[model samples]
Target: MERDRNLMRDILLTLALILAIDAVVVGVFALLAYPWLTFVHAPIAAVVGTTAAPVARWLVVFLPVLALFVWAQLRFTRQELLADVPAGDATRDTHPDLHARFVRLCKQADMQPPDLAVVDRDVPNSFAVGGVTNATVVVSEGLRDALSDDELDAVLAHELAHVKNRDATVMTLASFLPALVSDDRKILNVDGGANLLVWFVLTFVLYLLASPSLPGALFSVSSVVGFVTLVAISVLGGGIILGVLTAPVVLLSRRLSESREFVADRAGAVLVGDPSALVTALEKLSDRGFELPDTDARTHYTGVDGLCFLPYGLDDTDASTDEDTFTVETRSHPPTHERVANLRALVDEL
Candidate 1:
């Protein structure tokens, strides 16, 4: 019952956050575009011999902004999110056992199997991306080696739970707005975020020349320079201002993300009918990323932390070489102990 409540709460929260961030995006565009509406519609007005309605100007401005957002959302998650993570596709020919296990689990869960990406590392971690219908689950080589069959099934089921709930898609889509303001996320998810800014400036300038709002000239010296400067400030300055507005939503994401992680943990447990297996799996793999055989553990940890099953590698080690476990509220995942505790509680309920 508690798990169900958390699941529903997270679903609602995810939707609310998406709507909130989108609202902020539209609001920012409206604010920036309103000042230039006269220049935007002046050319069209002259062509038709009558001024366009005020709403017409906004519609003209909003259409492109909306289009850009939709395009960015799809391109960002599908292409850029996995651009940095090193993983190869898992095929039944190459990974017969793992592929079979995934297929069986999905059948039990009454969902289709998603594509799998295998990372050739000793780190035991996995995460899902995209939606239920179009999802990819990533697994580290070390993960299969570290856990027992049941435990591996538990971990895979956890990722499958994320796919089933569509939290992975929600999280990826949710990152779009926050990524605009976040440098760390930009590095991973957004290859060149200026697509919107570039498109916005292009549309704004094109209309400026399509028909002149002022009588002198499109390139008039004194007044033209001032008008150009205003346009620059309105468009460029809006980005800086919108970044400030999104800061609060970014903070809100921390809590909502943590909730979703917990829900995935519980849901993954329910999916497999073995909450204790997940608990054991998480505890055994807690030491992941330490003494990693490949790249810098810290960099890789933070790089995939958002999409990883656990935030195991995102922490610092103490002098004794133990994970610090220290975390800030801004972190997208809850602490390891908290996840284990939640799972343990679910076990008790069963």
Candidate 2:
């Protein structure tokens, strides 16, 4: 009952956080559209006496935003699926015993067995991808070599729990806005700040062209230069404001992510009927000090880190590291010792 209550509380908090982030995104877009409507469309509508102006403005402002959101979600989901594809042949024939164990675990949990992929990396880590009907479990080669059958089964059970809980879909949708903003920030940094400046200038020019009050003669060389400067300042100011507003939402999302890890651990333990197996598995993985290669590390920025069995940077020695203060603030997963302790507590109750 306590576990159920914690799950319910986390779910409610996550939902509320997502809603709050959605509200902020909508509010920011509306603010951006206000100037365009007031200066560009409204005056033209007043002169032409058109009732369709409001509808037109709404479509102009919202249609592309909605389309972009849909496109982003699909694109990221595809990327996640692609990321999980086994780099080498990972068939039942390659490891019959492991396959049999996976099948048995799936049956025990009363769910269809998800496709399993073996990552060629030596990192002892695992993550779940896709949604309920299309879920895939990706395990690393190092993981297969490092653990006994019981420990490996526990790890698989954890990833499968993520699948059964539909965490992939929920996390993907919840993370869409943060990913979009984070990508934009990356682009801006890569382009030496020119991307944002160019975007703002283009937006302003488009608005000016649409406005009947602005004449083409005012678009002189000097005027154009001044307008670009003004747009750059406005864009910078808006970016700062948006960052301030969304920072808390981003932190909240991370907290929700950490909570999901605990929930998955409990669910996985229950599915396997052995919390100690998972605790042992976690300790083994941590002690090995496994790390993903640079190429694979890129996926973590895209939100896949949240789905991993352990937080990306954690190792056995992290507990003794000097960066404990920094780790406590920014680490996505809860401390390994705490998670293991929680599992041991659950074991006691069982």
For lDDT, the strongest prediction is: 1
Cα displacement (angstroms), candidate 2, residue 180, comes to 4.4
TM-score for each prediction? 0.80, 0.73
Task: Please give the lDDT score at residue 3 for candidate 1.
Answer: 56
| lDDT value, candidate 2, whole model | 0.67
**Clash pairs (backbone) in predicted model 2:** none
Model 1: residues with Cα > 4 Å off, grouped in runs: 35-52, 131-133, 183-211, 288-302, 313-331
Worst 10 residues of 1 by lDDT: 313-322
Off by over 4 Å in 2: 34-56, 78-89, 93-95, 131-133, 174-230, 289-306, 313-331
Tens digit of per-residue lDDT, candidate 2, span 1-350: 67779776977777687767666665566555544444547654775557877666655666676666555665666345444344443568997777888899999999998777777766677888775358777787878888988888888998898888877766666666665555522323436468778877877776575343333456666656654554565577667766665566567667776777788898889988999999999888767744343432212332344567865521212123233221112116777888899899999999
Question: How many pairs in model 2 have backbone atoms within 3 A of each other, for residues 3 or more apart or on separate chains, i.e. clashes?
Answer: 0
